[model samples]
Target: MTTALGLVAGVLTTASWLPQLRRSWRTRSTDDLAWSYLVMLSAGVGLWLTYGVAVADVAVVAANAVTLAALGALIALKGVGRGREEAAR
Candidate 1:
């Protein structure tokens, strides 16, 4: 039951970011997203993934894995876009 609860919570928390991810991907707009925040969040999620792997918790592993991927993509998009904007200047 605890594991099930964890999975449910993980799903909810992870899914919460889906809309933002989708929107960012569609619009390629991340001007409002902060670089430091994304970096810190990615770091924190990486730690959670490490903990999940260490303990062999499927829910944590899955959630953090997907979250990290999405975060990585967003960061890449934001970074590249920012670079392009600077180059255009």
Candidate 2:
């Protein structure tokens, strides 16, 4: 039951990033997303993943892994968008 709860929590929290990712992907712009925000989120999520691994929490590990991937993609998109903007200038 606790594991179930954890999974539910994980899913909810992780899903929060999907909308932003989808929007960013569709628009190919993440100018609204601050670099500091992305860096902090990635760092915090990485730590959660590490903790999950250390504690052998499958739900946490799974959720954080997915989140990290999303964050990585977001960061990449942000960089690409920045480059595009710079090239335009």
Candidate 3:
């Protein structure tokens, strides 16, 4: 079914980032992460979320929504860490 396929695709795409998320959380380090790439990915995910809503795609919406939240948290943490480092200098 198309819905199942979409769900699988969404899952695969979203889950692909979990390892990095876990690593970042565990190490409490975003040092190796690229800020530009993360910002771009967040924006891309936002668009995907919008597309999902537009097309009434439940799988896309759910997957992108969760990914956005997770990435957003990571971005916030990175920003705060960067700010602290900059302040310390």
What's the true lDDT of residue 82 in model 1?
A: 94
Alpha carbon lDDT of each predicted model: 0.93, 0.93, 0.88
Which stretch of 10 consecutive residues in model 2 shows the poorest summed lDDT? 2-11
Using TM-score as the measure, the top candidate is 2
Question: Residue 50 in model 2: shift from native, Å?
Answer: 0.7
For residues 1-89, write the lDDT of model 1, one tens digit per residue: 98788778989999988899889989989999999999999999999999999999887899999999989989999988899999999
Clashing pairs in 3: none
Query: Superposing all C-alpha atoms, what RMSD in Å does each candidate have to the true structure?
Result: 1.3, 1.3, 1.7
Encode model 3's per-residue lDDT on 1-89: one tens digit a residue.
98778778889888877887788878788988899989999999999999999999888799999899889988987988889899999
Higher-ranked by lDDT: 1 or 3:
1
The residue pairs that clash in candidate 2, if any, are none
Whole-structure CA lDDT of model 3: 0.88
Q: Could you give the candidate ranking by TM-score, starting with the highest? A: 2, 1, 3
What TM-score should be assigned to candidate 1? 0.90
Q: What is the TM-score of each predicted model, taking all chains together?
A: 0.90, 0.91, 0.84
